[model samples]
Target: MFVHFDRPVPGWEPADGIRTLVFLANLAAQETTGDTASSTSTERLVHRLVGSTVHDVLALALIDDLPVPPGSKLSDLGYPLVPATGDDDTELVDDAEGFLLLGLPLQEDTGVVEVEFILDAGYLPIPGEVLEAEGKHVIHRLLAEAERVARVIGRNTLQTWLLHSPDEPAGTGEFADLLREYGYLPGLTEIQGFVDIQSNIATTAIGESLPQDASLRAEIIRDLCVPEALIPGLIELYRLASVEVPHGSLDAEPVEWTPRRLHQAAKRVVTTERSMLSVLLIDDSGVIGLSEVTCHPGSDPDVLEQGITIIHPRARGRGLGLLLKRELLHAVATELPAARRIYTSCASVNSAMIAVNEALGWRVLSGGSGWQKHLPTV
Candidate 1:
């Protein structure tokens, strides 16, 4: 039997936290080999792998408490473990043979919630063998719980659920077939992009200089104070640019942004050492182009994750998106020279951004599609 903890990270006991960290660490070890898997210097690897979850939990908690921000509700389910009690203590017994981590998004009625699931490397059977029954059972239970959450947060019944995996395996792969067996239908595709900063610095020099248009200006916003007047423009730009990009499914909506939501996002950090950086192209009208990235100095200082890069519709044709992106790259290189790689995700249909990424020497690491299922009316 599996024990579930619905509480936030701060609520979890030390033992519970340790169990989850060890499970994640082992999972990483399984996925890696050679020097990475070697126990000789695994402390850093474990910190990086397990630290990610901790950061996410803290970031989620940093959002405002009432009227939860859109796309901020995340319910996590850890691997199954037997619960045990001692004379003076309580702890989880991790003698179990399988592991799974599921993160489910609880959205509004008629909205889509994304499902993120991971399994122990061993549980993945080769071509013909049946999928592990234990992992399958855990997934079902998690989905049921997700449905209950959606019902509570939503109107009456949950509407649509989404899952994403590599596009190549969606139709014919074993894992894809398994998801299909349940109720998921393949939907929009996404492209994963990666760039090695050190290698591309020379090629992306245009970013070395700011936008040249006399009417336009650029600035990098970090932990500095945000101007009061520009907040509304930033919110509007987000709404316009984000909606224009394809989300999970055709019906999926971009996150609703409010002034409060914007402030919360700007100030939130996963860890104390984590830094949120945004490169913005502004005009007398307001922010017209933007690029964002985050770095985790405490856990893994060498990797940077790209957030969003958008150019206003009116400002489109001037290569501002590329300008913002390259400028952001240079900013990161200057501020965090230790950063080695930068990662980004773009909807498969966004060829313009994809072309810009290609121009900066970013390469496609993987391709995945969002799959959705519309639940039956209750």
Candidate 2:
């Protein structure tokens, strides 16, 4: 006699009817995944937990259903009731089955909400037959609700996320087929990784930076800190670098970059204090290279996720990419010392970047698909 319903964030009704889609991870999958006991995942779970967007929330519970935190709102995720920290949270965790989250950057363009889901490889054959009836079929419900919400928001696409880890968990292939069957597109494949930013490997590499005469300065973008006058420089930057970014497929259309898009992106970063965008400028050229590492919305304060790193073609071959990274690493230590781990991902096809990551002590954690750097705070 199980019935399912979504609880709206209190005091936050969707005037546009784009109420959040609540998806529950059944940690106690009595009928599915054979993970009825209780399982915590670092792969899929960490990425979702790494960085947070302006509008996000991740509520965890021990029950079969998702827990919606009290006083939750679309504008903010109420003070996170962190696990393993205080006695007050014991009651909160004990009350629910698992967690529910409203995650990262909604499509400002289309109003789509995005989320990633994964299961441990050790768990085979996600018991679709047994739980489909218990909770309206978890995966199917997510897709249907996503679609329903997308339609209400007046958009046709529900650009939610679906990641494929290298481990190729037992049921992943089947799950993806089901996703594609449900109208989801295979948009992009990303590698998840981490590295020790303070390790001997990275310190040695940073030491190789060109002497002080190099005349390159790195600045992390903050609250409209990048004057409008400098926007064009970043625009020119996109024109030269975006073509190289890995995309949907080898034959995919070239990304159409625009100055307005660059400005819009820079403006969005200002909304969050934790987001970091490090730009390198040479004395002669306006904007030569840049790197962006955004801390996840509800991510551990000690970590930030890689966003973008690009060096203009004219500035390449001189190790500017390495320089940009080295200097940005300095920014992390001095400016964001409390931050401990830095994770960046790239496509398997990007060998050059992969090589650079290897040199910087970044190891691929997700079956050799992405790189992660562990930044030692001390």
Candidate 3:
């Protein structure tokens, strides 16, 4: 017999179906906390191991379920249903009968919780015994369920698999050979051509500085949403010639720029201790332009230019975009040179920005289908 019950997270709805499968491992096990005579230290360890393994599988499943629209929230989907209590003897028996049947411990708690999970051979995409090994069934089930859910939601399912745990097997060559027999390959593939900050700076610098003139400087300030007091004639003198301004060069018409949003974004860039924020600008008339937001690593300053847009339409054009970016890069190199390798991502479809980044020597490091999934409220 199976027990069905509901448990909700405060201020968050429960995950249902595949989300439940993906998140079940993270859910606090009923036996994880609170006093329980039913659980021994060994049993507790087994619970943790099993829970963590399931959690990882579930995460992949959730990723497969995400919708295609950018920035879709989990709340937009139907809440997941929490698992029923597993502490009872009946549920434990059910668990043992299903996927948890292998390596059944004759004397758990007194000894180790011994069990091996089985993988269904028919479901695997890769042909090999490694994927067919025991304990792989959890991952197989997760992938199968994720694929089913993806089809229902109209999305493609990505492949996900599990390999044997490296640490637990000790130096037993047999266990290693067994995992190898299953042909399990660990880790995801690498992405190429992604831009790091050092490359961005070198490529962006055209070796031509902004011209010095009070009127031109004023125009530049007007284009950027900076405070008038912050605008100094000498600011133009420090202009690095190599920086390439993309938006300012675009033929798009000028848009209204707001100071409040600019100030807030600037504040965030200046205040964040970690290299999670950057400021960029673009100018057209050799005067004012659009400012942009970005981030880099705190430890490795060279990894600058994680682009995040804080300013929207009002500040379009004006070259402030590249200007802010140049200024921030200069600031990091001057103030925090120890850091290396900046990283950023843009939609594969944004041609204008992609052109600018290409000129700056940024490359595509990784690319995959972006998706979003939604569920109506119950």
TM-score of every candidate: 0.71, 0.59, 0.36
- Give the Å shift of residue 354 in candidate 2: 2.0
lDDT, candidate 1, 1-378, per-residue tens: 333323323322234333443454444433322112111122222222233311221100101112322333234433222221112122332333332233333321234444444343455444346667765665565456555544554422222222222334434555566557767776677666577777666655634455556767777778423578777777887887657777645454566777876765555453334577777788877888878887643335666778778888878898778777777788778877777778677877889988999978876555556666666656
Q: Which residue segments of model 2 deviate by more than 4 Å?
A: 1-136, 169-172, 200-208, 211-224, 227-229, 238-244, 249-271, 275-277, 281-283, 296-298, 367-378
In angstroms, give how far residue 300 of model 3 lies from its true place.
5.1
Error of 2 at 347 (Å): 2.4
Candidate 1 stretches with Cα past 4 Å from truth are: 6-93, 96-112, 126-171, 203-211, 223-225, 248-251, 270-273, 296-299
lDDT, candidate 2, residue 56?
38
Report lDDT (CA) for all predictions. 0.53, 0.47, 0.32
Give the lDDT ranking, best first: 1, 2, 3
Identify the superior model by lDDT, candidate 1 or candidate 2: 1
In candidate 3, what are the lDDT values of residues 190-226, reduced to their tens digit?
1213344465466444222233433332122212345
Question: Model 2: how far is 8 from its true place, Å?
Answer: 10
**Count of backbone collisions within predicted model 1:** 0
- Clash pairs of candidate 1? none
The TM-score between candidate 1 and the true structure equals: 0.71
The 10-residue segment of model 2 with minimum total lDDT is 14-23
